[model samples]
Target: MSQQTSILILDDEPIVSKRLRPSLEKKGYEVETFTSSVDALARVRERKFNIVVTDLKMEGVDGMQFLTEVKSLYPDTEVIVITGFATMATAKESFSKGVFDFLAKPFKLGEITEVIAKAEEKINNS
Candidate 1:
């Protein structure tokens, strides 16, 4: 496996990607940010990513739909769902759908780094 990993960050809020992009890039990840799931889905079809990090709620396409689509098209790409509204139902559903991870909002840089690192490791191993 290559040391260089590609990660897709999908969120309607620019700040989520803004804050995450630099941090992940600094960790040596090739990161792409999409403000819309529609655009992100197009990109996903074009290129293969090691992991996809997405917000659970968005204006047009919700995270669950995005998650389902990504899984259907790219089964190898791991997904991490992040949301401010963390509920038991969401957690159970995401896991049942084989989501890579679930992160609530207000996550620190360190926490995200750890999760990404873990996911990357899993992908590399697989």
Candidate 2:
């Protein structure tokens, strides 16, 4: 059997990470969650994650910057950007920066699950 996919979730809100962890874990992903971007970045440097789901707006190291950093450090890591402040420009920029998916806030768990499935497929194929 193949190894479990590793995922890192970064958001300023504790509830975001809290809500996503169990759901992704249940889907068989090896999940790590962080409320602080700094802490998350530190972890990212330590290990390669197959996927990263991160909030766009945060106190330190906003999602766009974090995405750039992750891509630079780990080009193969698939990134999904989730944002409360979703805009066409931001979404465009995310795509330009190699984001795998962009999800708006208040999304259903099923939506994320679908996206995760897609990411998993890509990882497996790669």
Candidate 3:
């Protein structure tokens, strides 16, 4: 089951991955986390992830660009944007680019889990 759903999480902070990886993996998800957008972008090009969780503000290849690329490569891949700098504009922009959801920073773990479950259902349906 874990092999069936691959998730890639990208954030500039190591702690974000540290906190998320274990929780997600414990739920039988194939989770991979990276602190560098460049590396995450490279990985995305090589393989497919069922869901992508990314931070909008990063040094290189910000979330907007990253999500755009992911949608182009795999239109069905669900993207959830998480950022400390969330705003109405960013949320609107993300939706315009076909993101699955938008969450602000410091969200509860359960919030993400619920959203991921929704994404999974959508994926299975598609």
Candidate 4:
């Protein structure tokens, strides 16, 4: 919390978390990852994060639902939605619900990094 750079990564795939954690940590973010939305929600309730990056296609609470919950519970927390099933509908829905950014799957690491940078800026300003 306190507006320092920290990221919470919510992805069911171990591979995604594995690839992303080191890069974001190297950039100086305090990082936490969860493969379960239930557990992530508990963590979110207990602590404030600079950003929350969640996969859109999860087994329990999918990304869209997660986005809604995040905004409702932690309105100031920036939420980035990432999905392999990228579509116009999903993009529109995410924006309508106030997602910070949307990233289609197969996106380069730099692209996600840019989104994280933007989130940091927003957090700092707020």
Best candidate, TM-score: 2
lDDT, candidates in the order shown? 0.91, 0.93, 0.93, 0.88
Comparison by lDDT, 1 against 4, better one: 1
Cα lDDT tens digits, model 4, 15-123, are: 8889899999898889999999888888888887879999888898787887788888888889999998899999999989888999999988999999999988988
lDDT of 1 at 4: 89
How much is 120 displaced in model 3, in angstroms?
A: 0.5
C-alpha RMSD of each candidate structure in angstroms = 1.2, 0.7, 1.2, 1.8
Regions more than 4 Å wrong, model 2: none
By TM-score, the candidates rank as 2, 3, 1, 4
The C-alpha TM-scores of every prediction are 0.95, 0.97, 0.96, 0.92
lDDT of 3 by residue, 1-126 (tens): 235688999999999888889999998889999998999999999999999999999997898999999999999999999999999999999999999999998999899899999999999888
Per-residue lDDT over 16-115 for candidate 1, one digit per residue giving the tens place of the 0 to 100 score: 8999999999989999999998899889889888899988888887889989988988898899999988999999999988899999999998998899
Q: Model 4: which ten-residue window has the lowest total lDDT?
A: 1-10
- Clashing residue pairs, candidate 1? none
- List ranges where model 4 is wrong by over 4 Å: 1-3
Weakest 10 consecutive residues, lDDT, candidate 2? 116-125
Decoy 4 TM-score against native: 0.92
Q: What is the lDDT of residue 98 in candidate 3?
A: 97
RMSD from true fold, candidate 4: 1.8
